[model samples]
Target: MNTQALGVEYYLAGMRAALDDLPPNEVAEIMEDVEAHVAELSTELGENETLEQRLGSPEQYAQELRQAAGYPPRTERLPVTTKKQLVTRPRVAAWGLAIATAVTLLAGTAVLRQSAILLLPAVLLVLSLALVHDRGPAQQEIMDLPETRKIQQWLTPEEGTPGERALTYLKSLQPAWWLARAGLLGLGAVLLASRDILGFLFIAGIAVLSVFAGPRAKVDRRWLWFSLPASALAIGLLFQVIDVTANNLAYSSSRQVYQPPAMQSYENIYAYDENGKLLTNVLLYDQDGNPINAPRQYYGCNGDDPQPMIPANRYPRPKIDYENGSCYTVAPSVVAPSSTESAPPSSSGSAPSNSVAPTSVSPSK
Candidate 1:
């Protein structure tokens, strides 16, 4: 960890411990200001003056914070909550968490292609359990405050609730919470090294803003202004990449007609089948003056070694010859002004020795 990161972690831990009796919302707010203050101080302090040298011990700094925030000194007794916190908060938090967990798990597994969504609920569950055991503010005036009553209630153990048993389990595993958070940071760092560092940093920043901004507290509009649009843009880019990749795969799978290079005037075309019976419907002008019927692709040949010949361009037109003797001559009158005429056949289905089919017309036609 960087010195700055370590200092922030230690200072925040002490602050949380010091403000244990306060409402979670208040603690969150105070910590936000503390973080901002520590960040500011870090920029100004000399190398000789560490955070401890400047701010003293975390417990002492926390006491100063409580006094500044108009709170009494820490006491051995448990904290108290208002009627609103007691009645409405727990149920609302429980339902909120339940719904959030279900949606996160489903969306992460189904849409985002990330399994890390499962870790989210586990972390939330740990925090929820820890909240159950922590004491709330005991001051009646503080509890009665309108602002405090309006905020969401923190989770705590209640009669007939599973949190009662869970609290003990959570308390036994407080050290694990630290480990989990550290692991999260380590994972984020690894992802930065191996994956998208900008994305990781952006997400980490958004998460920090969301936590410290508090549901009802006013911190900075800038964090909101930046995070929301940036997140939307990131999602948009992800969709675009997915769409482009799909298109590339679809295009790759579909057959492509080979286009010979423009630099080469003559293109060699060949076809072969191991069974040697590749038949194809061919459009040819018959011996009469009439054109053949509409020539869709058809199986026309039936034998092996259908030797192909291409007439050289020395002739007035290009033509093709099939040694199999399937192609027959078209009368000179029947051949279109544009169509190349096939050479006349001789005795026993053989083409005239001197008559040659032009090369270009056969495959193209």
Candidate 2:
């Protein structure tokens, strides 16, 4: 019990320490004794005076009780530091704490933007801290310091701290910050080869923007202008890469002869269906022993052009019919020739009425 200074805080602290070991019954007895003392004092003062005034002061009363109990006076004990004092904030301290807490909350929210689970505690903590820090110190002694000559200035009609002003400034830039974040995400997806790296960059961008939403961060970067558009452009270029790779693979597999391709005409063109794109020009070949030419594409065939041309380019002589109705190409086997030898003499027989196979040749008698 080192109560070097006797103050209100020390007086209560001493009592609390004594009560820690004392039973509930003992505490009740102490209370009753104090009440009895006050009552007696009240009676002596002739009911006109309050019991409080007759008792001198609460501290003095407690001191006398200590003497009567064979305990040292509360003033002779050391000061008892409390959790209350530790947590309590001075005016300036409160403002600084508020700014730091606000910044922390914003930073946390930004970091956890993708995860709702993480953002809640950070937000709750910020609000709680702000509520507490916004209040001035519990006790203030007024002095005639020139308001204008004060070391610090506030940004409002009412009074505030530089941190509050900073917070307000930060709040104003949130929209831009968010835009930048989305832009940076795109940029990262472009620049980062690994998926994990890209994901981290995306989260970082979100955090940066989220912090900007609070009243604590400063933003004055020039290169910030290109962040979003450049990211989008990069993403678009990736689409092109996918497209080229897909086309290359498609071309390699196009050699399968079993699956027929979309119909084409004289000048080569790609064909399409209602649903989507189709494989085109699978049986590529040309007449007169030449490489196939690009064929024209048509979705529908007119009455004059009923049967669409399917090139049967397997045989020799490479005959390709351009007739309107004949869906024609050369057969796969032998080639026909322009020149022919003379036919040998033959005997003719009359056709039978019901004989399915009646054609016969006999030597003339």
Q: Kindly give the number of clashing pairs for every candidate.
A: 7, 11
Best by TM-score: 1
| lDDT (tens digit, per residue) of candidate 1 on 170-265 | 767744543443344333334444455554554455334433433212233223222232223234334544665798987776635554434422
Ten contiguous residues minimizing lDDT sum, candidate 1: 331-340
lDDT tens digits by residue: candidate 2, 1-365: 22333333334333445442443344444644554455465457643454445544555665566677775444423335522244433333334333444443344323322323324433544444444332222111011112322533443424376777776887688666555545544443443434455445544554455434322222221112122222332344345445556988887788564566544322322233333323334454556666554323222223444233445321122223333533233322221222233121111211111211111111111
lDDT of 2: 0.38
Q: Model 2 RMSD to the real structure?
A: 22.7
| TM-score for each model | 0.29, 0.23
RMSD of each candidate relative to the true structure: 18.0, 22.7
Stretches off by above 4 angstroms in model 2 are 1-55, 65-97, 113-302, 311-365
